[model samples]
Target: MNVEDAPEGVEEPQILPLDAWHRARGGRMVPFAGYLMPVQYEGIMAEHLWTRESAGLFDVSHMGQLVFTHDGDIATVVRALESVLPGDVAGLGDGRMRYSLLLNEEGGILDDLMVTRRGSEIYMVVNGATKYDDIGHLLDALPDDVTMNLQDEQALLAVQGPKAVDALARLVPGVEALVFMTAGAFDWNGHALWISRSGYTGEDGFEVSIPAEAAAAFADALCAEPEVKPIGLGARDSLRLEAGLPLYGHDLDPETTPVMADLGFALSKRRREAADFAGAQRILAEREAGPAVKRVGLLVTGRQPVREGASVVAEDGAVIGRVTSGGFAPTLGAAIAMAYVPAELAAPGSGVRLVQRGKVHEATVAAMPFVPHRYVRASASPQTPSKAGA
Candidate 1:
C-alpha cells in the first residue's frame, strides 16, 4: 500500500510495514493506536502467557517518533521544552532517555512520553493517538530555533520478555552494557537502527526504531531466534499491566495530573527545584498537600478481572472512583487492575471493592509491579557511579 504519502483525507488508518506479514502468520487485526495492528497472532491468552516466559515481538510503528534539533543553542531549546514538559531535559546526556509528561495549565497530564538525547539531537516518542496534538503543542510552545521533524520514515518494534536480552545480544553484541533508559545505534544485516533498552512490559527488552522499509525484514530476523514469537496488542496490554505500567488514555489524561496519577517522580529533583515547567504551580501544590485521589493497584480475589471504567467503592458501598486499566495478569496468575481512589484509601492493604456487572468483587489497594521487573541496566563503577542512568 502506498500510504506513507497518502493525502490526509484520502488515507485509511495507517498500517505498519508488518501488516501483511502478521496476517500471513494468523494475526487477528484490530484498530489500536490509530493503526490496524494485530491484536492476536495465535490467541490472546496464549500470546500473553508466552511473553511472560519468552521473548515476544511487537510492531509499534503506529507510535509517533519526533526528532528535534537546536539551531543555535541546545540548552536554550531544552529550557523551552521544559516550559511545557515536566522533565529535566537540560540534565539529560547523550544516549539517555527519560519518561515525562505534557502538562496542562492546571497540572493535568496531557500525555505521557519518552524523551531521548541522541548526541546533539533529541528524539521523542508519544502515544500514537495523541501524536498530532502533541506535535502541535510542542511546535507552538518550544523555541523558534528548535525544529521538530515527524519521522514519517521510521517504524518502531518492541521485543519484550525474560529472553529479550539474550535474543538481542546475538545481533547487537555488548548491548548488555547498556542500562535501562539508554539507547544506541546498531547495524543489522546492513540496516541502521536505533535500539533503546526500554519497553512498557517491564521486561529486559529493547525498542528498535527502524526505517519503515526495514521494519518487516528486521522483525523476521528477530523471529528467527527460537525464543522469539510475534506478539499482538492483546499480549502487549496484558504484559504492561502485569508490570503495573500505566496506559495513557485509561490511566492518565488531561483530567488527571501527574501527582494524582502517582507519577510525580517523572518531575525530577531538578525540575522540581527549578520550578519552571508548565503547570508547575499546580503540580507542586498537589505534591505538597497530596492529591485528592490517588492511583493504586488492585488485586481481585476472584478469577474474573475488572477492566477500565469499573466503579471502585468503599467497603461500606460508597462509590469512590473507577478502575482505569486492568486485566488478568498472566504472570501473577490473578486478576489485577489499576484504579484511582480517595487518597486516604491509596495505601497498600486498604480495602476496596470493584463493581463489575452489578457484582462487587472484593479487592484491596496494593503496591504495583504486580510482577517482578527483569530490566537489564548498566553496571556501576567508580567512574560510572550510578551507571543506571536516570
Candidate 2:
C-alpha cells in the first residue's frame, strides 16, 4: 500500500517478474518502492469492489523475503531475533506467524514486519523500501552463527477476499487447510511454494511465495478462476486504508513508537515482562504512563477525502497533530483517515478539526477498520466472524 514517486537523481526503477504480464493485462505502470509496478488495470473502484465481494490477486514481489538459520539449534536464531524485535519469537508454534515491530534503541519504530517459525528456519517478510536497512540491522544484531538468506529469486502473490480460498485451493489443493497466520510448504507444477493464510487486505486471503520463473504461469492459473481477477496497487492502498492497516513510511516512521501508533499487541506479554528486546525499558514505561500522542481513526463529515499531510488543528487554528493516511473508503461510502492526535482526544467520537489546503473539515475520532474484517480464524464462532486486525 506504500506508493511513492522516484525522487530526482535516483536510479532507474527495477521491474518485477510479472512486469510484462501486468502490462499485457493493461495494468498502468508507475514507480513505487523503487520498482515499476501497476497502479491499476480495469479501475481502482471496480477492482476494490470485486475484491471485497469475490477475489483479487496482487503482485507483491517487491516485499523482502528472508530466511534465517543457525548452525546450532533454532533457539539460537530465535534468541538473536528476539533481541532486536519486540515479540516472543521462542513462543511461536511451528507454521504460526506473528506481527512485530523492529525498534531502535530509543523505542522508535524502524519498521513493522511479519515473522513466522517455519520448520528449522525462520521466515520473515519486510517492507520493500526498508528491507535493505532491515537486513543490515539484523546482520548487526545477530551473532555470527546465525545466517540470513535474502530470497531474491522469489515472487510474492496475494489472493484476497471472501472467495480467495475457493480460487487458491483449486490450484494449491491444500492451502484451504491453513488457518489465519499459518503457513505451509506445497508443490505446484514441481515448484516449491510457501503459502500463508494471511494478507494485507482485511479479508480472508493467502500469500503465495513461488519461484520467480514460475510466477507468470501461477498468476495466469489463479486468474483463470472465475472468482479471481488481477488487482493493482491503487486498490490495494484503499483496501488497506479501510482495514486500518498502517503504512510504514506514512503511518509509521523512525520517530513513532509502538504505543504511539496503537500497536501494543506487537509487544508480547512475556517480552514486556522479561524486558528483553531493543527499547524495552522505554516501551514498557510508555505503556504504563501512556504515550503523549495516540493514533486514531477519523471519519470525515463530507464526501471529499482528506489526504496525508493534512493538519489536525484546534479551534484557534493551532496545529495539534497530523494525518498519516486518508482516502474515500468505497466499502463504507465515506471519507476516512488515520492520524496521531493528543492522548486526551484519542477516544472514539471525539471531535476533530482538520485543515487541508486552508479548508477546514469536520471529523470524529472513530474505531478502526471503517469496514469490518472478515478473517476466518480457527476460533471464530459460526454466528460471528472474527474482527481481528491484520
Candidate 3:
C-alpha cells in the first residue's frame, strides 16, 4: 500500500537494511516512509499481544539519524537549537535525551524528535517521512556556525516490552543501568552502538543505533533470545496507540501547536520561564488561556473502530473535530480514537459522535493511553560529565 504523506509522484520504494530479513521472516511488506517496510508478521493482533507479554524487536532504520555539531562549545550549539525548539536543550545533561518539537515561526509543530547530548556533539532522531523536510528546515533556520550531518549509513532498532531490558542486557552489559530517556555508547561484538533507554511504545525498552552494515547481524542476535520476536509496523502502531503516544502526520502537523496537542510538557520549565524559544508568545498565551481546540482520546461505544479523517460531531450534528488516529484497541477490547475538539467538549466523559463508514457511532471523551505507560521514570540527580564514544 502507498504510505501516508508520500511525495506527490509515484516513486520506487526504497529498501531498508533489514528488508531482506523482514521478508525472510514472513513479513508482509508495504510502502511506508518511502521504504518497503514490514507492516505485519504472523498477525497484527498476535504480534501486538506478544510485544506486551514479551520482548518485540522493531526495525526503525527508516528514521532519520542526525548529528548537529559546532566548532564552538556545546553551549553554543544548544542555544542555537533552543531558538527553534521549545525544549531545554541547553540544560540537558550528557547522556540524557528529551522529546522535543521543531516549531515554525508561528509556534506550529514542524516535527517531533528525540534530542540527545552526545559529548560535545548533539544527536537527533526524526521521523522517517519528514526527515528530508526537517533537514532543509534546519539548514535554513539554524545559524551558519552550526553544522548538520545526516547519518545515512546508520540504522536503528527498537527492543520494546517488559522483557526488553533483560533481552538487551544480555547482549551489551551495563545498558541495564541506563534509566528511561538516558543513553550511552557501547560495543557489541566490537561494533560501536548508541543505545537509548526509550521507545515509542510505553513499555520499557531501548532504541539502538548501529552501523548499517552490522544491522542485520545485530537484529539476528537479538531475535536469537527466546523472549524476543521480530514485530512489524502494524504492531508498532497499535502499541504506540495503546501508550497514548501521537504519530506525526496523523495526530500532529504544522497546523497544531504543543498546547493544542496536549504536549506542552515538551516545553521545558526553563524555556517556559524564559519564554525565549520560537513562537513563545503564542504558545505561552495558549498555555495560560488554553487553545481554542485540544487533542483528546475517545472511546467508541461499539466494536467498530473509527479511522483517520472521521468526522467528530456534536449532539446537534455539528462537526466539532476530526479523528486523527483511531482503530480497534486490541488491548482495550474496544474501539478507541484520538481527535481534536473544542476545549470545553474535550473533557473526559463528554459525549461525542464519530462518523465512520457513513455511520455515526456513540463515543465518549476518554483518557488516553487506553493502556498505562510503563516508563521507568528516573530519579532526581545532578548533571554528569560527558562520556566519549559512538
Least accurate stretch of 10 residues (summed lDDT) in model 2?
1-10
Stretches of candidate 3 above 4 Å error? 1-10, 380-390
Q: Which stretches of candidate 1 lie over 4 Å from their true place?
A: 1-11, 380-390
Q: Which ten residues in a row are the worst by lDDT in model 1?
A: 381-390
Report lDDT (CA) for all predictions: 0.82, 0.90, 0.87
Question: How do these models rank on TM-score, best leading?
Answer: 2, 3, 1
So what's the TM-score on candidate 2? 0.96
**TM-scores for the candidates:** 0.93, 0.96, 0.94
Query: Which of the two candidates, 1 or 2, achieves a greater lDDT against the reference?
Result: 2
lDDT of 3 by residue, 54-81 (tens): 8999999989888887874788788888
Clash count, one per candidate: 1, 0, 0
Candidate 1 lDDT over 286-340, as tens digits, reads 9999999998999998889898989997767788899999889877788999999
Q: What is candidate 2's lDDT per residue for 217-249, written digit by digit as tens?
A: 999999999999999999999999998999999
The numbered model that scores best in TM-score is 2
Q: List the residue pairs that clash in candidate 2.
A: none
